[model samples]
Target: MPDLSPAAFILLQGARVFAPDDLGICDVLLAGGKIIAIDSAIPADIVPDCQLVDLSGRWLCPGFIDQHVHLIGGGGEAGPTTRAPEVVLSRLTRAGITTVVGLLGTDSVTRHPESLLAKTRALNEEGITAWMLTGAYHVPSPTITGSVEKDVALIDRILGVKCAVADHRSAAPEKGQLASMAAQSRVGGLLGGKPGVTVCHMGSSKKGMQPLYDILETSDVPIGKLLPTHVNRSEYLFEQAIEFTRKGGVIDITSGIPEPIPPAQAIDRAVRAGVPLAQLTLSSDGNGSQPKFDEAGNLVGIGVAGFESLLETVVELVNGYRFTLPDALRPLTSSVAEFLGFDNKGAIAPGKDADLLVMTPDLVIDRVYARGRLMVKDGVACVKGTFE
Candidate 1:
C-alpha cells in the first residue's frame, strides 16, 4: 500500500518487536535498505521526509527465511508435463518469506544451474534475497563450472551443493564419493567465504541415515557440514535426525509432510527428545513435486508443495502447541539464516537488512517489508512478478 517501491526512509512505530528474540515495544527506522536505528522513539524532525506508520497493535518479527525451495520449479519424475511451475514473488512475500535458498531436486537435467542462478537474480531484482545450491540427485552432480568447488567458489550466488543420498532416486554414491563431495564443499566454503553446506535430500529408504553415519565415521568432514533435510518424512527418519542433532549436526524439517509426524509435531518431539533447538531448521520445499511411488517405482500421484505451510507450521507451534513466540520463530528465521550464512538477514536489528513482518494477534500476516520495500500491506500484496 505504501507505493510498493523501496522507501528512502520509513519509520515503524509502537510495534512489539521480536528481533526474533523479543526486543519489547520500539520504533524502527529504515533507510538505504537497512535498519538504521531502533529505539523507544525517533524524532520526526530528524528525518523530515521519512514515512511514518503506526503499528501499535501489531507484532513485528524478522522476516522468514526458507532454506530449501525450487525457484525454477522441481520434478520431472512423472514426465515433462509434470514439472512444477516457477514460483512467483507475491507467493513468497505474502507468506512472510523475505529470503529464500533455491535448489534443484530430482531433475537437474531439464532444469539447469544457469536457470537457477538467473531465477535467484530475478528474485533479488524484485527486492527479495535469494541464494542457491548446485547439483541435483546424482553423484558427479551437475555444476555450473563442472565441479562443486568451482561452482561455490566462482558463483557469487551459489552457497553449496545439493544431492540425494539413501533414496531410491539417489545415485547411491559410495562412501568415498560422499566424502570427496563433502571435502570439496568444505574447502570451497572456506575459500569463498560461504556456508558451503552439503544439502542432502533424505528419502524414505530403509537405509535411513546409515550413509551419512558412514561418512561421519570414516571421514573427517565435520558433522555440521552435512545438512540432511526431510527428516520428518517418517517417525523412524525423525528419530535418526534426533540422534544426528544430539551429535552436533543440523537437520532440516520439511513443512509439508503427509502423515505420522507433521513438522510442528516433529519439532515438539525433537525438543522432548533433548535435541538441541539451535541445531534444527525448517524449510518448505516449496514448488517441488511430492510424488508418491509404487513398489515398482511408478509414480502414482503427484502434488505440488506450497510455501505458505512454513508460516502455518509456525503459527501452529505457537497457538496450538503453546510454544513461546520466540521459540516458534527460531527455526523459521535465525536458525536457518545462521546455518546458511546469511549474515545480514534472519533478524530485525540496527545493522540488519530491513526485512520484517507485521502480524495480527491471531498470527495472520498484516504486512511484509523486504530490504526497506513494502511488498504487502494489510494482508494484500501490492507488488507482483513481471508476468503475475
Candidate 2:
C-alpha cells in the first residue's frame, strides 16, 4: 500500500522540522530519492503534480541510522535452537531505522559473511538502505574474501570488519592484530569509497578497553578508525569509554542494554566528564543475543535486542534530560553518519537522502520514509519482507 515510483515528487507541508537542528516549521520536497529543497514555505504547485502530504502537527526528523545490527539474525549462546531469526523489512522501518550496518556476532562458523551480504542486498530491495561489516567475534576473522582488506575494498556493501574482545566468548586477538586489522580496514575504505572502520564488540569483562589503548600506544592505527561498541555495558567500562573518547576515539553506547543505569544517563555522564558529544554514538545491536552470565560465567538469562531502543533512547535524552532535540538526535543521526563516513545521510538537509520520520507530539512514530519511499505509515509497517 505504500507503493510509489522511485522518482515521484512528494511535498510535505507545515511540519516542525528537526533536520536534527530544529529548523522550526518548514516544507520539504523530495524527488529522485533525495531531499530536493527545504524552506519556510513551498507552494504545492512549486513542483508540478507533486504529491502533497499535510503534516502541520507532526515533527519531522531525520530517520535513525542504527550502526550495529544482525540482519541475518545473531545468537547461539543458548545452543543451536537459540540463533535469532532473520530481520524482516517491517521490523526495521517501523522502528524508525532507515539505514543499518549489519554484522555477524559470536557464531561465524555456522553463519557466513556471505549470508550477511545477501541480507544487506535484501534490505535495500525491501525499501531501506543497508551496509555490512565482515567477520565475527573470532580472530583471523572470517571474510568473504581471503582477507579483511579484500572484503572491505572489493565488497561494495561491506564497510569494514568486526571482532570482539574483553569477554569469555571472544578470540582475544592481540593488540598487534587489532592494529593491523584497523589499518587494513582504513586502507580498504580509501580504495572502496567507504568508511572501512573496524567495529569492535566490547564485552563486559574486567579487561574493559585496555586492548584498544594498547593498540593506540603500540601501533600507527588512527584513533578514529576503531569503533568500540557496547561501552555502556557496565559502570567501569563506561568510565573506560570516557577515557577513550577523551583520547579521540569514537565510542558506541549500546541502547538495548537494560542494566547498570540507562544509556541516556551513561551519555550524560560522558558529557559531564568533558567527553565530546561528537565522539559518542548510540546503536541498538538489534537482533543480537544479549546473554547474561553469573560470576561463574554460566548463562543465567538471555534476550534478543530489537531496533526499538534507538527511538526510545533519543526521546529520553530530550524530554527526560537537558538535551536539546538536536543534541539528543546527534548519536543516532549526525554522529553516526559522520562516523560511518556516509555523506548523504544523518540530516534532513537538501541533497541528503529522503530518509525522514514523522512523529506525534508525545513521540510516537507516525510515518517513515527511506530512500524517498514510504515504508511505514501511521505507526505500522506498510511494506514487508518477501516471505512475509
Candidate 3:
C-alpha cells in the first residue's frame, strides 16, 4: 500500500522534464503511488496541506530500473569465503534504483531462487519495487517449485529465466536447450502477459554469440526472447551484442567494469555503430562479484559492482560522450521498464507511478522516490529496510 495523503503533493518548476511523452512546463501532482494530475499549476489552496518541493530548475526524470542485478550473494568460485553479502535497501535507494530485478549468478546451489524471492519481497515490503529471474547459471536451473517454464508463467514475481552461456562455470546448454528454454519462456510470458525472455548471462568465451545465432536460426522463438547481458564485457562480445541487436534481439550492456574496454566507450561505440536504441539496455550488476580468471580458470582477483555505477554510466554518457539525457536515460529507465512489464515505471505521466530522481546540474542523484514515497533526499537515504 502507498501513502495516499489527502493533500496532493506538488512539485513545481523544473528546468527540464523528460516525461517520456515530452510534456513541457508542467507541475506534477502525486497522490498515493500514482500521479493524479499534470498541469501548469495546481490550486495551492486545494491541497494546502500537501508537501511542496521546488526543483529550482533542475533535471527530474524517472528513477532508474536495473533489470539484471545479483541482489543476493553472487560468487562462490573462491570457496564459501568469497560469497558476497546481500544488498541493503539503502544501497539501492541512494543510487536511485527504485526498481530491481534480482537474479542468482554462478553459484546457484548455494543461493537458491526461493531465497532471491524472499529478498525481493523484503525489499518490496520495505517500499522499493523488486522482482527476480527464475533460474541461474546452470542448465537445470533452481526454482521455487521447479521448472523454469512453470515458474515464469505461474509465479507472481518471476518474470524470466536466466542461464549462463559460453562460460566455463556454466552448463553451456546446447543450441537445442537454448531454443527449448526460449520457447517455454515465450509461452509462459504470453500466459502471464509478461516479457518472457531468456536472459543469457554471456561469459568471456571467444565463441561469441554463435550459440545464440544457432538457437535463433533453428527455433520458432522470436528474437525478443533472447537477451544477452554483459555484452560490453569484451571487444568481441560488444561487437556481437551490437550484431545481435541488429537481428532483432535485445542486448544489455552492463555498467560494471569492462575487462579491456571502459563501459562508457562500449556504450558510445554501440550507439555510434547504429545498434537499435530500443534493443539496448543497461544494468549495474550490483552486489555481485566481478571475478577475473586465469587461463586455467584460476580466480586471480575480484571487484564488486556498485549500484552508484548505474547513475555514473548515465553521467558519463551525457557529459563526456555527447549523448542527451533522454537518449542515455531511456535504456536505464523506459527501455528496461517496458521490457520487464513494469507498466507504471520508467516514465512520468498522469497515471504512472511517481518513481523519480532529482539530479543536480552535475548529474548527481539528489533525491529519489519509489511509487510516490520519498526514499532518498539530499544525497542520503530517508527510508531503509530493517534488515540492514
What lDDT, from 0 to 1, does candidate 2 have? 0.89
Give the Cα lDDT of each candidate: 0.89, 0.89, 0.81
RMSD, one per candidate, in order: 1.7, 1.3, 2.1
lDDT-wise, the better of 2 and 3 is 2
Pairs of colliding residues, candidate 3: none
Model 3, span 1-388: residue lDDT tens: 3342323465545435667545655677788777777777666555656777777666778988998888887887788888999998899989989899999998987899999999988888888889888888887777777777788889888888888888898996887777777777788888987788888888989988887887788788888878888887888888878888887778888888655766677778877888756777899888888898889998999867788888888888888999877887888888887777678888888788888888887888888888888888898987777856
Shift in Å, residue 350, candidate 2: 1.0
**Ranking of all predicted structures according to TM-score, beginning with the best and ending with the worst:** 2, 1, 3
TM-scores for every predicted model: 0.97, 0.97, 0.95
Higher-ranked by TM-score: 2 or 3: 2
lDDT minimum window of 10 residues, candidate 3: 1-10
The sequence of per-residue lDDT tens digits that candidate 2 reaches over residues 53-96 is 99999999999999899999888998988889898888999999
Better structure of 1 and 3 per TM-score: 1
